[model samples]
Target: MIHENPPLLTRIRPWVFVFDGPLAVGLALLVGISLVTMYSAASDYDGRMFDHVRNLSLAFVVMWAAACLPLPWMMRSAVPLYLLGVALLIAVALFGDIAKGARRWLDLGVTRIQPSELMKIAMPLMLAWWFQNREGVRRWYDFAIATVLLLVPVLLIARQPDLGTALLVSAAGLYVIFFAGLPWKVIAGGIVAGLAALPLLWSVMHDYQKHRVMMLLDPTSDPLGKGFHIIQSTIAVGSGGIWGKGWMEGTQAHLEFVPERTTDFVFAVFAEEFGLVGNGVLLLVYLLVIGRGLVIAASGASVFARLLAGAITLIFFTYAFVNMGMVTGVLPVVGVPLPLMSYGGTAMVTLGLGLGLLMSISRQRRLVQS
Candidate 1:
């Protein structure tokens, strides 16, 4: 029988296989190219699509570098990173330029940056670290304190009127709480309490948020206004039928019938061009990314590693699923992007951090014998 290497770095450095890293990279590359193509189609030959591709390429490189770094050091820096994220959020809230009736981004003169994007990683990282410290926190009150930790950022995010992002951050933190073996009874109790306090939450919701729910209930009531986005998206997706309209041929995108075609509604564009098969492929890529993540979680090297990796993994799943589901009329529309496939800076960085955690776990596994 042959034996694996016993050298420290030799045993550890090979963890990068990562369920066929080449295939994952190839698929990611294919998807990015597709997004760039869709961007051009939507732009009607604008130069901005080129810039989007450049940024996306840069994001991939950053993710690669992060994935190669060590995990313990990253976790050690968790508090500082979380504080930095909070500071950025505060900066955005206090002195940020306003756009589209929401103060969601900081104007860097050349480009706009959103801080809430960092919370997607920071929240999970902080919670995992918290659990690591309170290793024996097996009580309901401990879970409550954890919930408070999650709520603080959710409140800050909601104050930005970025409800979609607020919901996402909430989901990220909630994943940690749930994974901490939080009692099911407490969860059910919280659900009941939430339902009971629906009126209070509704009171705090921005007018536009309430209208989203209303429009979802009856798009026909306001076809030209709040309902327009969902209506256009459904038309674009449904028009694809079995075979799709073909790449760069979606009239919805070409004719500008689809809103946010290169961003929020990119899935609709992909669906319209590729039809059911394209959608199926997208789902497969997503499943592969998430499946590899879960495998890491199941065999993760430590509790912190497991929690951080698992939350990030499911958060990725949440991102793809929410974006696709919302675009397809199966879920309420929230502005969640489609992870690596979506064009954005903040989201890409978060995905990079997440990929780093997964790679960290994998690295630990390989180094186990060393």
Candidate 2:
């Protein structure tokens, strides 16, 4: 009289169980939009677009793979994953490959790898696990310890002179700490201390780093040299106006005025082609993705899931915000990519992994509820 149970994967389906309905839909739309913009930015049916398609396909593969793993498996993997990340980072620092004056990559026989990218996920996962273990017994000392854990790799990255990724990794870790209920006074004090140490920090910065900040203050001071990117990108966004120039008809990108058109500066191309209206729509979609992430976080079955979900969501926000802000001349260029939109294999993979983790958390919540 008893019925046989369905296969594990089949039981979770309707496909939404793995993808999470709203998040999956939002991602589809975002990816579609990204492809459309990339085509225009690319200005031809060529290898660039094909490469993007390939990268996106790989990213989804990663997402699906991560989603299929059970929550306990992910939780158990956190420490080892984090330790591996730190070891890789140390390896990068000690005997890594140097390209373009930064020692951020390890040449692993077949291919070069950037270890800092691993910390983007590992830093948050490690912190979330730590806080989950200390759930009810959190103290100021614990928060300080969390900060140290967060800063170790951050300082290493900055030493690579990759201030952008360092900032991102730090943000990811800090989000977990904030979600764990770190005191406002501690946050405030850290801010004050950072501000107070600005002079010393400035002295220690590499010339290029110093130049970026200086250019942010007054790009016109060296318009032909350092200010070129901000100036051209801002012009592209402004030229887009209310309704855009109508897709590939964009003068900025077609004319090659917008630098890094397929990568970090891709937002300028999107803005130029689609205009203010397109930008608005894209922003709304990003907000929706973030909203879905927060919902997942709030509904998570465990403290670890909640913290990880929230951190990943805000990391998406930070990526988009920093990229847009830099392109618009509101912030200094720090080489951040517009999530799902920018053309880079590594960034795409990182984003996919984070979303996969979010999907895993969402799936866990649903399982708990059922």
Candidate 3:
């Protein structure tokens, strides 16, 4: 028998089915916004805009490849990835290149890699795998062991003075443990203990870290120095008013008042150009992505899938929340970039890996059900 070509959509359905619809829409919107904002934010820096686009394109590919992997393959690979990340962390501690007073990068003969970024995905993967093996028989000690696993890479990253990344990694692993039936009383007790340890935490903080906290409390104390970032970013955010200054018309970014306008503080550029209404729309898009992720997590076909999906979802939440909080001057600047919106290869890749895992879990669930 001879057949004519299939309908256009029918021919493409297999490719389209690889990604979750809502998640893809949300990511596309954010990426579009990132491109627009980058055009304005990086206008003064030749080639920066092209670099941003390249990074984002690479991220998209990473996400696509990740989504194509089987869940069983992901589970089988978890321990090896986790072990590799930890070993890399140890190597970083011993011989990583120092940049801006932080030893967070390992210089290979060709390219430098940030081992801590690997931990961002590996931590949650390892924890989810651990809990999946325990399944219904989990106990308090399981959590204790998991906590220890979480702390190793966290302490290593923190030793590099990369508090922002360490915090993100910690949150990722904790989300897995929490979703694996961690007790509420234990959570409450941990919070209480954390609060009680504030004094000791303060005593051990690096000088710059302490300064950041102080600046958060009062930016004017050192307005021209350590506080310049907060002050200028907050101005950019507030000056946008209800409707924003209009795209590419933002003075703070174009005038060079905002620091890191294309990277960590890109939100300030966005707020300045798009205004309050724009911020609301951006937040709504993020919420849509987050909501879709949680839905995927809830429908996960196995315990491992559920925990990994949930942790990865909340990790996105953490990225956005921390980045916006610091830009608005409500929190200390910890160098957390806005997810999918910031201009950085490492973060984009890490986030892409996360998005891929979410899509994979979601696709797997649909496959099993159908």
Best by lDDT: 3
Q: In model 3, which regions exceed 4 Å deviation?
A: 1-16
- lDDT on C-alpha atoms for all candidate structures: 0.79, 0.92, 0.95
- lDDT tens per residue, model 2, 1-370: 9999999878666354587889998999999999999998877436999899899999999998888777788789999998898899899989998889999999999998898999999999999999999989798899989988998889998998799999999999999999999889988998999999999998999999989998999999999889999999999999999999998888988888888999999999999888999999999999989999999999999999999999999999999999999999999999999999999899899989999999989987887787
1-370 per-residue lDDT for model 1 (tens digits): 9987688877755544442363366447556645755564546657656756776677666666666666787779878888888888888889887888888888878987788888888899899988887786577787878888788778878888898899889999999888889888888988999999999998988889998888888777899999898999999999999889887788887898888877788888888888898788777777777888888787777778888888988998898889988887777788888776666666766676677667767667667745
Q: After superposition, how far is residue 195 of candidate 2 from its true place, in Å?
A: 0.8
User: Per-prediction count of colliding residue pairs?
Assistant: 0, 0, 1
Model 1 residue 119 CA deviation (Å) reads 1.1
Give candidate 1's TM-score: 0.89
Q: List the residue pairs that clash in candidate 1.
A: none
Task: For residue 340, give model 1's deviation from the true position in Å.
Answer: 1.9
Ranking by lDDT: 3, 2, 1
* Model 2: residues with Cα > 4 Å off, grouped in runs: 1-16, 44-46
Taking all chains together, each candidate's TM-score versus the true structure is 0.89, 0.96, 0.96
Which stretches of candidate 1 lie above 4 Å from their native place? 1-33, 36-40, 43-45, 107-112
In Å, residue 272's CA in model 2 sits off its true spot by 0.8
Model 2 reaches what TM-score against the true structure? 0.96
RMSD of 1: 4.2
List model 3 lDDT by residue over 1-370, tens digit each: 9979989999877566799999999999999999999999999999999999999999999999899888999999999999999999999999999999999899998999999999999999999999989988888899999999999999999999899999999999999989999889999999999999999999999999999999999999999999999999999999999999999999999999999999999999999989999999999999999999999999999999999999999999999999999999999999999998888999999999899989999989888988
Better of 1 and 3 by TM-score: 3
